[model samples]
Target: MIPTRIAVIQGDPRARVDLAVGALAPRLISRDAARAHIALAAAGMILLGGDDVHVDVSVGAGCLLEIEDVGGTIAYRADGRRSSWTMEVHVAEGATLLWRGLPFVATDGADVERRTTLHLATGATAVIRETLVLGRHGESGGRLASSFVAGDADGPLLVEQLDLDGLAPEPGVLGAHRVLDSVIALGFEPETTRGDLVLEHSGAIARHLGAETHTSRLDRVWDEWVKRARQRTASHVDKPANEAAVGGN
Candidate 1:
């Protein structure tokens, strides 16, 4: 059994969840009242051969949503067929969404395809983090193709595709590496002394292609972006109250 899809939409002041779940689908573990969002926990044995999963998320104007996964996701050995995972996200003007994704591991004989698309309106913000690991401890992994596209109301901000196979020697791509970790930040740009790939649009992307231990290369950038995002959200949340107080005075 595999989970087909999970959708989350922002209501007046909270987020609503709709699940199309199977026996092996991830379950909602906890909800944060202050954040007005919920967390998801993966269930027993997930993502076997021919498994397909989709997640859709929308944040209404002026709202905030946060999503996190409990642990890493493993793709078991697939004889021939492949497993697919897709995620689509939409953020309205003045809204924000933060997603903390766990690592994805592909064991030997596994084939997987992962895609992510994000659309943001003017004044909206989004932060997404992802890590892909080819194999487990000492073994070489299988094949994985990952695609990501993010844009705002005006036009596309970033478009990228990464193809990786443990059987192939990629001197130009990974070059003796097994991990690809990245973070995408939209509607906010931070200055960094280190090298970071700056997109054509307003946001920026930080990526590291090396061993799993080097995944922390983007930690500083991620931390700065998250801090700024939280501050922005706090100010937005207090605006209405501040206005009301001024009116009363």
Candidate 2:
């Protein structure tokens, strides 16, 4: 079966939703205060062989958009075919986008490919989170190829690719880890702690690799980055009001 496809666009200074479209079980769940939440409603046993899902999102100048998943997505074992999921995002100047992705589990014999591409204009910001788990307890996982590319009008901000197999330990890739959690923040420079991968560009990536119990390694970094991003956005939003107040006085 073909995977789900979803697209959303937010425009105007008020951050109103200008367009929204979805197919194959992914739909907009709610909207409030310039924020929209999308949910994946795929029924039991998702992302089987030959499934292909695509999501496209666009945020207009000065708009804000948030996306989330209702629950974890499980990729069942494949029968010699590959399943894939891809997301493409575009953020206009001064726009902000936050994607809270839930866990993706790959069971034994599963084959999956996941990819994301982000394009940002000057002053645009984006925050994205991902968690990949290899198999459930007591079972070795399958094969996965995960890749991400992000850039702005100026230049490329990040490009990364990982090919992993749960049963084998690569020399330099994931080593012996079974879980990988990551958070990517772009368009702003925030203070980071040790272990945070600070990029040359105005962004940082924090990742955790280990058993599921080690997932907390990314919690502190993710929380701090999210807080900083929200604060920055709030300041930008309040700047005009403050300037107007001063002018009136």
Candidate 3:
């Protein structure tokens, strides 16, 4: 599978970012000394049949990166064919990453597997937003296997996996709901305490489930968590200056 790569590092004049095109095109939308914004646009039709896609991203120490998705993706049915998508992310010490992703819909007769993993160093921060739709309008959806794994320098933060098939609808799995929206913040505490699960490590995940995507209540959670995540980035950014001042004295 051809892979898409994006990386950012601290530089003298500004932060330098690198990008390579594969299934998705990574375009630099905006940048400053503190953070760089990149938009991921689909290069062509995706996840039709027997397709595999991979994305790799890295944020260097003392730098930040923000990613935006241009559009959502829908998996079209391909006569019992299977597809897969995987993403890997790494954040160095004193770095931050923010990603806002669109919906990933699995249509009827489609089969797809997706996995995402995150690795964080000491004092690293990350906030992620994801929306998973089971099917299109009035459709029973297809087979989906989704996994999320995250860890820090000390230990693992979160590990979750779900297997949903359109043929079965039960009480424990989705339970008549078609949408699952989640907002995750790592290396910081969320200001909102209610209706969210705090991880054993340093992080929180706020999730919402509903029949429809428009009525989902995760927008407020996303805003609050993003605010808290940005606060942590500020402290990481200022540490080097403070250390230099101490060394001079």
Report backbone clashes per prediction.
0, 0, 0
**Tens-digit per-residue lDDT, 1-249, candidate 3:** 689999988765456778888898888865556567788988899878798889999999977788989998888795878999899999999888989988999899889999999999998889999888888999989888999999997888989999987768666979989888888888887775677898877789888898888998888888778777777777434433211111011
Candidate 1 TM-score over all chains jointly: 0.83
Per-candidate local distance difference test = 0.71, 0.73, 0.83
Candidate 2 clashing pairs, residues 3+ apart or interchain: none
Question: Which of the two, 1 or 2, has more lDDT?
Answer: 2
TM-score for candidate 3, residues paired by index: 0.92
The reply for model 3, stretches above 4 Å from the true place, is 235-249
- Each model's TM-score, in the order given? 0.83, 0.84, 0.92
lDDT of 1 by residue, 9-74 (tens): 444333454555442243443222123343555655666888877776767666666667777788
Instruction: Give me the overall lDDT of model 3.
Output: 0.83
Task: Write the candidate numbers in order of decreasing TM-score.
Answer: 3, 2, 1
